[model samples]
Target: MLNIRCPYCEEDRPEIEFRNAGEAHIARPDEPDRVDDRQWADFLYTRDNPKGWHAERWRHVHGCGRFFNAVRHSVDDRILLTYKAGEPKPDIERMLREREA
Candidate 1:
């Protein structure tokens, strides 16, 4: 059982409390119509599939009913960072300010 932190709920929840969404931060082309077939294919099919740390989008289903971001170490499934949805990632220095503010 993995331990997950839900930024919206502000609670340390179990992995069961959330659902694993696909790769986070997928950016679409600025001009969809201008994109060629090859470009579109690459964009749809290619993924980083990193071996080290990775950031993913997770949906907190059992908690605050919101989505958040998590930076986790892929090798051992160690969570490195978590932050609110659509907001910038949390920094140790600024995260404290976020908590205080």
Candidate 2:
């Protein structure tokens, strides 16, 4: 089973304890009423399906019950890192470079 690290709990737990919450870093419209139907639809439905490293939101349901962000490799389904919810997305390119060093 996949192991996911919870940023809040500071421990690695089984994937069964967590729930994938979908793509992270999605920004809601500043004024929902002002947004057109098409814009609203795009915001609600559109998401990146990248083949490589992707940032996603995950909830530690069975553990801390806190939501966190994680960078996972889509091809291998390996979680590279986890961070708190409001933290800025990490630079994946830099991280890969550092890993190679």
For each candidate in turn, the TM-score is 0.78, 0.96
- Show the lowest summed lDDT stretch of 10 residues, model 1: 88-97
Error of model 1, residue 89, in angstroms? 5.5
Backbone clashes in model 1, listed as residue pairs: none
Total backbone collisions, model 1: 0
Model 2 clash pairs?
Answer: none
Residue lDDT tens for model 1, 14-97: 899899875667678999899999999878877778876677899998778898888776789988778877776445456546
- The reply for model 2, stretches above 4 Å from the true place, is none
Model 1, C-alpha of 90: deviation from truth (Å): 6.9
Q: Assess each prediction's global lDDT (C-alpha) against the native.
A: 0.80, 0.96
Q: Flag regions of model 1 displaced more than 4 Å.
A: 89-101
Ten contiguous residues with the weakest lDDT in model 2: 1-10
